[model samples]
Target: MTGAADLLSRLVEEVNPSSAWRDSFIRIPRHRFIPDRIWVEDGDDLAVLDRVDDPDAWLRSCYADRPVVTQVDDGDTTGRGYRSSSASMPSIVAMMLDATDLAAGQRVLEIGTGTGWNAALLADRVGAGNVTSVEIDPAVAAQAEEALGGFGVHVVLGDGEKGYPPGAPYDRVLATAAVQHVPYPWVEQTRTGGRIVTPWGTSFHNGTLLRLRVGEDGTASGRFGGNAGFMWVRGQRTPHGTLDGRVRPDHEYAETSTDLHPYEPVGDFEATFAIGLRVPGMKDLVVFDGDVPGNPHYTVYLMDPGSGSWASWRIRPGPRDYRVRQHGPRRLFDELAGAYTWWQEAGRPAHSRFGVTVTCRGQRVWLDDPGNPVSPEDPV
Candidate 1:
């Protein structure tokens, strides 16, 4: 019987190719990219992680469409907490490819060379000579170097956030780790008209796929393309606040002039903020807790005042569930409620309608539909 490599050769057809810049599926050997031990979910849920070290199981999981957890909390050795490292699932790699639209001879810059699986794929289509990948963790970079030995690419041992500048003027820049915003450096490194694809966070759950086009002056603009969950690069990891052992489950909506309805994709603040993540220094989050009940509610947040300014809407279902409190220049819950109402008013929703545009001055993102154009005088 054929081995894991043989099985991987068969799974390439699963990615949706129409949206891909290159219609071809990459041919990197799957087994070469995975570690001996990987964290797999115990069941369907993402919270309860189970470690799988068996080569065959790791191989199969590698080929799947999900990104497996590798490292847990910063100091975790048992692999039972927050996921910090991983070899993204093969299909997720394919989806990223689909988003990239890589073509032969096109130069590509890959951020976060976890296991070099993606770098190998970029090399396959763009030519190894054209691919430049960076990783922040020294050990991770070394591991990628070992994995991508034959791929013929520069596995730079540095922060992926800075990007590999030596390979400036790339045709495409892609990041495996989710980013809170599109760094200015990435935009500066790519040629005008080049495409930039990365997983971006909004004031919601996880990162959603983002597509931006570089302008002549080191800035890119675009919108959310799809929903994609990825670990934030070590530097971009969301730091959870010192929870007073409480999470508020109840959230309130704003008074809408338009006919409002219930949001179908409940608790998907991640999707709601996809396009907005391209703005530099933007970080958004929704804190929900089913574990503790009686405390004042913490909430979903959207913060980007350059110096960490933010906005939130809150309500303690326990204290005054009906009374809503909005704090910050931009009310995060109100924005979410607006989007949700827009979705319901327009017949549920579809992922494709979301869009984003980022500028050097400030950033703004829109979802389910491209928002109206803005002039300099327009309110942010």
Candidate 2:
């Protein structure tokens, strides 16, 4: 088998070919950043690979394009719960760097210092002195620091949400973790024409990337990049609460029938994103009929963690109108339908066509231009 250096060389050449950051890939060894005891997906379970036990396997995993799980459930719960932090996939990392449009001697602020691999790359691309990374977990930061060793990249053990204020007015801010909302502090800390390459999405969907450009007025607006999934930031993680604890299972619901198959439209990226903007603070779950494989009949449940409002839409296998049963103040299905119609009328724009603007006030998603908000016809 080829050594780490050979693998890294091939990875850069074949997977991610960036002339600017090619030297970074050649210089920095990814294996050094990865911990000995890492998690790898094994069938339906997560198996820990100890470097001492299987050096070759561990080295292969480190050099692979896939992400290696560093911490699970905030380093508390074992097995497979939630991946708190990870060494993100190399391809996506390369894509993010390309999105940043990094230039030499430009100061960069990295939101999450997971394994410090990306920070090392950033440091190599634009001098180590120009890179600053923030990690919420102290242990993760310590590990990253040790891996970075004398690299001169400042790894601050602080909340990524706040960003590194001491290193303010950065040329670019690259967030490794996904966030529900764009942190206003990031916008404030960036230069007028600075760019922010981060994964931004809602509870409805967790696969959208936003490459925002900071405006002169302390606001940032940019188009959505391709689909990129990452774990939510520590502070912005959604709480998983039982339905019985929040709302009554037998609660009376308002019945309504729609011609639209709730899943078909709601499952779409553009439609779901628009619906998420219209209906905030809601989590979605699609429950199939049984544990049987390849079940067609399923019910989509939309729950608002804040308000205890819930809605469920049942869909049959055949061509039948979906039944929507919603409870509480907010009619989720109705709102979703309206939002879907709104998206349709706007020419069914792709996720790339949509853009989001973040300011001290709040974030507003728009289509084509910032002047045109997504909810133009029906304002939420």
The most accurate candidate by lDDT is: 2
User: Predicted candidate 2: what Cα RMSD to the true structure?
Assistant: 2.8
Candidate 2 lDDT score relative to the true structure: 0.84
Model 2 CA deviation exceeding 4 Å by range? 43-45, 78-80, 242-248, 375-380
lDDT by residue (tens digit), candidate 1, 259-369: 221122234453344223323344554464664534445454455443333544343444333333444345544555565555556555444555556555545555543
lDDT of each: 0.63, 0.84
Q: Candidate 1: lDDT of 161? A: 80
Q: Compared with the true structure, what per-residue lDDT tens digits does model 2 show for residues 168-275?
A: 989999999998788889999999999999998887878688999999888888999788889988888778676566558678899887667865466777678767
Off by over 4 Å in 1: 13-26, 43-53, 74-80, 241-265, 268-351, 366-380
The TM-score between candidate 2 and the true structure equals 0.91
